[model samples]
Target: MRPKITFFDTKPYDKEIYKPLAEKMGFDVRFVFYHLTEDNILLAQDADVVVIFVNDILNEKVINKLHSYGVKLIALRCAGFNNVDIKAAKDKIKVVRVPAYSPSAIAEHTVALMLSLNRKIHRAYFRTRDANFSLNGLMGYNLNGKTAGVIGTGKIGKSLIKILKGFEMDVLAYDPFPDNKLAESLGYQYTDLDTLFQKSDVISLNCPLTRETKWLIDKDAIDMMKEGVMIINTGRGKLIKTTDLIEGLKAGKVSAAGLDVYEEENEFFFEDLSDQVLEDDVLARLLTFNNVIVTSHQAFFTKEAFMNIANTTLNNIKDFCEGKELKNEVKI
Candidate 1:
């Protein structure tokens, strides 16, 4: 019998890319549209492997249920796995992830947000559509000479640095263990966090979410940032404190914010909430600000990234089932 796999939180595109790959890998794949929760653990009963997304909860309760059903592996299609209980699955099941799909997809989207916010592109397009020939508040600054700060010199951060270099911007980076070779080669310099905060005209957060990174941008950090500084977050939502961010926006400490992720986004993101009132008050308030641009966590939605994510996830399952050593296996 072929090994069975169940994919949760699937959109049309996920089915489009993963179904074909699953067939090629000889797994009887089942795609479920809803997120997997404690109550929905039974959905994995007939499958040997369960694949989930960031929005799905892979807590101990769900892990135990999957174990009872004989599921041996859990595959995460995305990079971040804070939603997954690693300790719970360490002994019972092998956990893996598609660590890097396409860093360019996210890095490019970060710049897209900055350009739109800085140039008022959305507003300009709206006015052009209405035949208004005025450019009142559509002024934008030149990125060529400004200092840009990038936190975390990972694959995505490194890719963003290349783009910043092309723009002739002065780039500074902050990482605990700095990539000195990449910095030297790319003409970027590594600096301390305080200096990055004080001197940078634009601050971009691309770091992973860990105990040390949670709320890294708080009231005190905001105070240290240059006034009217533009901030961008394409990585994790928990890195920025929502309340403190609001204070920064209010006081012009944060001149503008371009967010592809939000701290309280789990409830609203990846789902259509247009008809209902937003349950999260802070998120609703952020939406009201003209200087803020919020995307539905779509930084990794490009065709290249989507295909790589689907193929990598399905391949991980196939390799596991075939008794082959997995390349992207996560060791808890």
Candidate 2:
């Protein structure tokens, strides 16, 4: 019998993409539309591997439950395994993820958010549609010769730096483990967080959410940034404290914000809650700001990225089942 793989928090697009890929790979996987909560852990029973996404709840309890159910491997379709309890799964189950599906896809989306927010494209589009073509408030500054500070010099960060260089923007990047050689080759400078915040005209968060990185952008960080600085986050949502960001926006410390993820997005994103009242006041308040643009965590939603995700996830499962080396395995 083919190995059974259970997928949690699957969307329509996930099914549309994974079904054909899995079929071609001669594998069978079950798709669960809802998130993997403790209540639905039974759904993973009898499966050799469990596939999950960012929103799934895989705490110690869930990891213990999966171990009881004989699930040997946990395959994450995307990068950032902060949702999983690696320590709890250690010695009981293995974890792997697609660390770099399409860095360019995410990088391009980051640029799109920056351009739309800075150039006021979102506001301009609505005004033109309403026959109100006033350029009174659509004024935007030139990106050329401005400084861009990028956090987390990973593949996506590197890609973003290359694009910023094309715009003639001087780039300052901060990473816990700095690759000075790569920075030199990319024509960017590696700086401390304080200097990056104090000097940059635009700041972008492209790092993973870890204990050290959680709430990396808060009141203190904002206070150090340049006045009227543009902030962009295409990374994990919790990187910025949303309430603090709101305060910065209100005080005009942050001129604009472009977010593809939110600190509390799991309940709101990937769903059609149009007819219902949004009880999350923080998210609702964010939508009210013309200077703020929040996307539905779609930075990695390109066709190439999706195909690569599917192929990598399936390959991870194949590798686990065949007892091969797990190149993408996440170690505790």
Candidate 2 per-residue lDDT over residues 98-206, each given as its tens digit: 9999999999999999999999999999999999999989999999999999999899999999999999999999998888998888789999999999999999999
Give stretches of model 1 more than 4 Å off: none
lDDT of each: 0.91, 0.94
TM-score of each: 0.97, 0.98
- Candidate 1 local lDDT, residue 5: 88
lDDT of 1 by residue, 100-137 (tens): 99999999999999889999987788899999969998
How many residue pairs collide in each prediction?
0, 0
- Which regions of candidate 2 are displaced past 4 Å? none
